[model samples]
Target: MKKIIQNFGTIVLIFLSSFLFSQNTNSSFEIKNSSFLLNGKPFTIYSGEMHYPRVPQEYWKHRLQMMKAMGLNTVATYVFWNYHEESPGKWNFSGEKDLKKFIKTAQEVGLYVIIRPGPYVCAEWEFGGYPWWLQKNKNLEIRTDNKAFLDECEKYITQLTKQIVPLQIDHGGPIIMVQAENEFGSYVEQRKEISLEQHRKYSYKIKDMLLKHGITVPLFTSDSSFYFVGGSIKGALPTANGENNVDVLKKSVDEYHGGKGPYMVAEYYPGWLDHWAEPFVKVSTEDVVKQSEIYIKNGVSFNYYMIHGGTNFAFTSGANYDKNSDIQPDLTSYDYDAPISEAGWATPKYNALRNIFQKLNNNQLPEVSKPVKVISIPEFKITKTASLFDVIEGKKSIVNNQPVTFEDLNIGSGYILYRRIFEKDEKGKLEIKGLRDYATIYINKDFVGELNRINKKYDLDIEIKKGDQLDILVENMGRINYGSEINHNLKGIISPVKINESEISRNWQMFPLPFDEFLKHNFKTKNIPENVPVIQEAEFILDETGDTFLDTRNFGKGIVFINGKNLGRYWKVGPQQTLFVPGVWLKKGKNVIQIFEQLNSNETVKTIDHPILDQLNK
Candidate 1:
């Protein structure tokens, strides 16, 4: 009797093992006649765009689950070329920038993947994801037949393929399709069709390269909406962008492809991104719920452009092409007023979308978690102990050569300090042309000048008295937001050292931000100055990860970072005072906090529970 029972158990175990193996090895995805097959059957994709590098690691699972609960079956992401390779042979895939982990997590939550590995993706990212260092190469004309650019692109694609190729349908993964160079035809004029043909050639080249590296998924190109009218085959999946309106989606379907195949919305708008001076945008949750319902009812597969908008962090955010009237630099916080805010909280829009998805099906949704906690610290006083001159007294490099633009100097981002020694008895008009943004002039360490964008010129005329040396500091506040001239952006002293419209020949010393140097420098404040503010450092314990706003009411204009994560610029006088720290970057243990206060010796900071968007904007 015991032997009979054992035989039955063995049979059951064998059967279960066979079923699991079959499931893992099956290619449930299929493509036929330009339609997608989900689970070996035709299925329309409801997709959303959320780059893995944009959001933090801790929130990846939560954001993916949120999308699933919002009626989206797929998540679309962009593989930023420059992000993977910061310098020429160096690659980083850890922390918030981990792409493969993000994709696998999406699959774990029952969501398919559409990878847009753009060698050139103009998603409003800095230089469209091309490394800033690439621009330094003298013989490169980005997005063209530049050998250097193409060679780098190939290397990046090869490395990325190793991570994603195995995750395709044939390998029991969620990736269904990969997009070729995004929106190429939109920029090229006159020879639109010819440009598209060129795009097709490159698209196939990338496709072949990926296949060589073992990615066998179908490839497609997102064409210009106008060009498609001339019989251009837009993306293999018959994709249309910004098709938020139901009528427009239907019209686009019939007009573009004769309404034959699956209808898809490649880019759906739920909210908008705000600039530094712009008012905080509050999107209507009702509008999102209504539009989503309409899309689903009409059998249209749509994806939110940013269901979970995350921070642009560091120098990665790109500007819009609005008219050149405003200096609308892309702000550090890419909150976007999205369904899931940059900080990763489930906003009212998330809840509304979740309810709509639940109503559409009987699928039991995952439990929604509570928001993270935020703590505030008591006010502490800070005083400046040293000046720039005192610290780098003898180590400054003086430039006697020709003046170079910031771009010419190859200084892409951050602040640059320029100092020159002026004879005490000299007085003349100190005019500086081509200044990108802001600058401050000092005569013998006494502040005597200020220049801003509204002034529209870097030339400053000042009276120079005898017995004083001249020191000037400039900051690339941000490049002008719009227009063709953006590519020529430079930070410090574009056309330097001018007196009364004529150039002044003097020994000029340049100090490029010294970010790493500052980090390693030790404080040697043996005697406290009564009026100067001190650069302070402290440590804290974070029990949870959530959105945090650093209150910089007491500190002047400068930068702050917590646990090596940049919290953005803070100014005691200006429009944005509090910096938003996304919950995902915070850890539940000891963390480092460092600050470079501008002025006003007394520095007291605290982290508040709520976002300071409304308070700061108002």
Candidate 2:
């Protein structure tokens, strides 16, 4: 009798273990009748969009929790190809670029994940997230069915799939949906030459490729409501992006989906992006609340385009061209005036959003996370400086008959110096025809003047003497991110620099000053004369470390680096006066700050606790 009782008890234990295992692992997500069904029930994806690369890895969990606290059950992210694969066949996914870790963290925070792995993500990113080497092919047409482009796209997608396929909902992970190529419909219209049929073929090709590579989750295409037809794929779900216009959005989706049912707004813009020399873009909290309420009432799922717009650190920011062919480079700080600011502080938008979402769900929202402390340090003095000329020695120099663009010289992002020696004295209007962006003229290592493309100022008054050297240091600023202009955004001197309508075609020396190379080399510890571009370094000791802003009021225009990590750029041009310096990059003992100033060579900078993000110069 004892043996039988023991055997029955063992059988009961085995049954219970199997039941729990199934309960923990079993998950079902599908799109039926237009509505998303999770665990065989309707689910509304109140989602927020944030990029892992934009936000620091240390703060990923914090951002995800904030999204959850705001009643967001889902998070949407774009996987940038160039960001992951900088070189051909070379990939880096560790650190902040870790996509798998990002998704896993979202799951840990109880937020579903929607992945938009774009071979091309036009997030105001340099080259639309395309690697600089793609232009090296010379004939590879991107965003199309070009064999070479598609071949490369397939390899990237396949490699990316291997990382996140296991994280799908069916595999007990949080990823619920995958997006087809981002907003291709908008691109189709932007480039009037591309036919609608071609766009459709390209869209389907990408979708088919994703499925071919073990992506079993539902696929969706997000496009502006006006361009839905151009971007939507036949087999994938179609979604729209807009602000507050639910009626038009519903009609557009219904028309595309054959009135079947489920509706979603993939990217609801709460705030707009800011460009250099432009006013900060913002939207009222009342409007956001009203629009969100409308969507919730209509059973519509929506995601904020940027719930937290982090910094566009380094040379990652791109530019846009207006109708008049004017270049507008995006500001480095991507603070988008979002609910969560650039420094991760919550705003009135956050409170309003939390209130609306909480009431809609009839559940008590989680308490907001405590704000991170910001510290203000005394003005640090720059003790060392290295002029541009001093650092150019022994650097790779390319000799050409005429000037070449950044791509032509096989360089990605940075300033390029073009040097030409004149045989005799020549004085006239030095016209740098087809100047891509900003140029600083120097005669025999002396500052002459500056020319900018925005004002169409390509001519500089010059007086060159015999045996004198003319050096034009041209900064790429940034490449045009959108429109047809992107195809021809060749940085540096595009055409020959002429003198009084005469093309000055002569032997030229080109020096590529990519920031990575600039930081790797050691600089001489000596002060250089002001007004010329130079690298400045300063060190400060901190008793305690916290987030702070480096004031650039005294400085002109330059990039800042803290402890070898790039904070971002700051300019005297107003709008963004301070760069956010996270305490994680700071040490308690001593911290190093480096600046590559383009104009003013101020050795001192103030460190403040609060950021001056929106103060515009009159």
Candidate 3:
């Protein structure tokens, strides 16, 4: 009889353990009494926004651990569509673009996930995160109820939901909320002719689309508090974005929700983004702590816009344009002066926030991870060189009467060269009506002058001899990621190349130098030309691998490729002088370094242990 009782007790214990495990994993998150309820209990979401594509895949866990250590219970990330679908019909989600792995990692680190999969994520990304191929369909208007655009968005969101649905909290995953559209309310003023009711209709369409595609989790819209009416949908919850203005934010939420409860700050800007020419933007630790305390005391949920702003690798950085059409391109490094630095190092801001959260939550914080080691490489000589002209000769040429933008050419990013022959000797005022960003004019293989869009310098005095080969190289610095001008950000010379206000209609041979294809060219080492853009190659030996910065202070504006991986662009124009080279991209022993210098070439580059991020050229 005693043996029978012992066996029954063992069985009961096993059953109870299994039941508790299942309950913990299958916890439901929902809205209850105007507050976020996790498993029927009120929960405060302390989230920090971070981009998975920006950080290396190997460091995802480290960054998430850092966020947890800083007292954040949740992570908010934006899914950049351009990063996933570079070209139409081509989808890549492996390596750095792996959103699934990122979410799973977050769950492992004990954090809930919030995804902002904006078919148009305006996180200062190129084309505002819209794939370049979308522009090919000239009739399809984006960010609206246009059938063509909606169809494409539907396909993308459908594919995305397939990956995310299984990971939602209801399905035993960590994802709690999925944002519908990003900051669409602030843009309503841009569409002056469109009524406020029309804006709400579009917002509703997106929310309905999310539901139709099997997104069971709650949908939310994030917008500035001032523009809540235009940005929010009827069914989806609305959240405000701001800093320290708790009263204004609370009032806005009450006005929208009709005095209901649970207030949330979707994007609390702890640090501001930096542009190429602008001063480095930083927020004091005291201010961040003050704002955070106010939110905590008021029982408000908030997420830092960028708790860790990583590198804008490749040509992914975006530009900004004002009402007057003034251009301000963002720097390569996204180090937004946040708690975590660009290379994932902790700063004073991190400590202050950690202290605040620990005191408020009364929970012991995790030990901070040790800083990653940085190594320095002695200067090495670049023995091999090839000119841009020689490289263009071997590429397939496209003939067009009038030049088209990069999208029309089926080229996504990098530089495009337009070559035309001047039949007769003439000196006239040459004007490129729609120069996208930057252009260099060459007459008879000689550098004549330069034109820039930032200062609106498009007119140039030129002298052309008979049969003089005219070459105008235009570099797509980056597309505007925000504001009203994003609708028409077509890179390259959009209009005809004009001389004396007359359109030059001649057979033009165009060469597309998209960086991915440009790197595959078999560059010649012997008899390289001078005074033009040249490709420089060097090999360095490393005893071990760690995160390091490639100092491009001596070199002119150009892109760096380490072992065929594009580290991103560097200019002498200040702000970002060094490019972060991840240890994963580096291997011990011999590693290849290639640079495509547009202006001046450097024989040697320093692989310094530290990054020179804020040093701007005077």
TM agreement with the true structure for every prediction: 0.84, 0.94, 0.94
Backbone clash total, candidate 1? 12
lDDT of candidate 1 over 1-618, digit per residue (tens):
996776577556535643453357576666665466766677877787898877768778877877766667789998888778866789887766677788888877777899988777756566667676675677765554456767777888888888898788778877888876666545444335345556455545655566567767766555434434422344444456665666665565557665665667777778876655556667688888888888888777777888887776666666553434224555666667788776667888888888877766553444565555555544443433455545555665647543455565556666666766655456677776656556667776667767654335556678776546666666665543222434454456666577677665666677666353244445566653433223556666655555677776556666777788766666544345567777656677876677755444444557766555533432
Error of 2 at 104 (Å): 0.6
Ranked by lDDT, the better of candidates 1 and 3 is 3
lDDT of each: 0.65, 0.83, 0.83
Q: In model 2, what lDDT does residue 385 have?
A: 81
Q: After superposition on all CA atoms, what RMSD does each candidate show versus the true structure? A: 6.1, 6.2, 5.4
Best by lDDT: 3
Tens-place lDDT per residue, model 2, 1-618, is 996876577556535643442345678789996789988899998999898888888888888878877878889998888888877899998887889999988877768899988767788888787787787787788888788889888989988998889999898888899998887878888877878888778778999999999898999888888888798887678888773577887888788887865789998988888887677888999988888888998899999989988888888888888855378888888888889888888899998999988786564455577667789999867877888877786787899989998888878887889998888889989998688788888888888898988667889878999999888988887788776677777888989788888888868999888786345447656656657888878788999988888888777888888898887767787788888887788899988888888887886878888888777874
Candidate 1, residue 333: Cα displacement in angstroms equals 1.5
Candidate 1, run of 10 with poorest lDDT: 480-489
- What would the per-residue lDDT of candidate 3 be over residues 17-52, giving only the tens digit for each residue? 434533466679887698999888999999999999
